[model samples]
Target: MEKTLSVQGMSCGHCKMSVEGALKDLDGVSAAEVNLEAGSVDVTYDSEKVTVDAMIDAIEEQGYEVS
Candidate 1:
């Protein structure tokens, strides 16, 4: 499944990398693409192996706010 999450506190390339890296590190995630200008991320993952809440937690752990 795929999801687009609205995120905040991203300001540059590193923020984009940080958000993408955190999401991609999840076991079920296949891909994570960040739109820095839009303050959002598009994530592709297996729903059976992961949950949206978990993904949100991961992003939060990286110091980002997922709404």
Candidate 2:
């Protein structure tokens, strides 16, 4: 499944990389795309392996806020 999350505190390419990297590191996530300009993240993940809350927490762990 795919999920789009609104995220804050991403100001540059590095921030985007960090957020994307964190999400992609999760077990169920197959892909993550972070758009710093859009302040959002698009993630493709397996629902059976992970939950939305977990995905949110993973992004938050990288020092960002997701809504």
Which one is best on TM-score? 1
What is the TM-score (0 to 1) of candidate 2?
0.94
Error of 2 at 53 (Å): 0.7
Flag clash pairs in model 2.
none
Question: What overall lDDT, based on C-alpha atoms, would model 2 receive against the true structure?
Answer: 0.92
Total clashes for model 2: 0
1-67: candidate 2 lDDT, tens digit per residue: 9999999999998999898998888899999998878999999999999898998998899999998
User: All candidates' TM-scores?
Assistant: 0.97, 0.94
How far out, in Å, is residue 55 in model 2? 0.9
Can you list the residue pairs that collide in candidate 1? none
For model 1, the local distance difference test gives 0.95
Shift in Å, residue 31, candidate 2 = 0.4
- Where does candidate 1 have its weakest 10-residue lDDT segment? 16-25
Q: Per-residue alpha-carbon lDDT of model 1 for 1-67, expressed as tens digits?
A: 9999999999999999998999899999999999988999999999999999999999999999989
Error of 2 at 27 (Å): 0.7
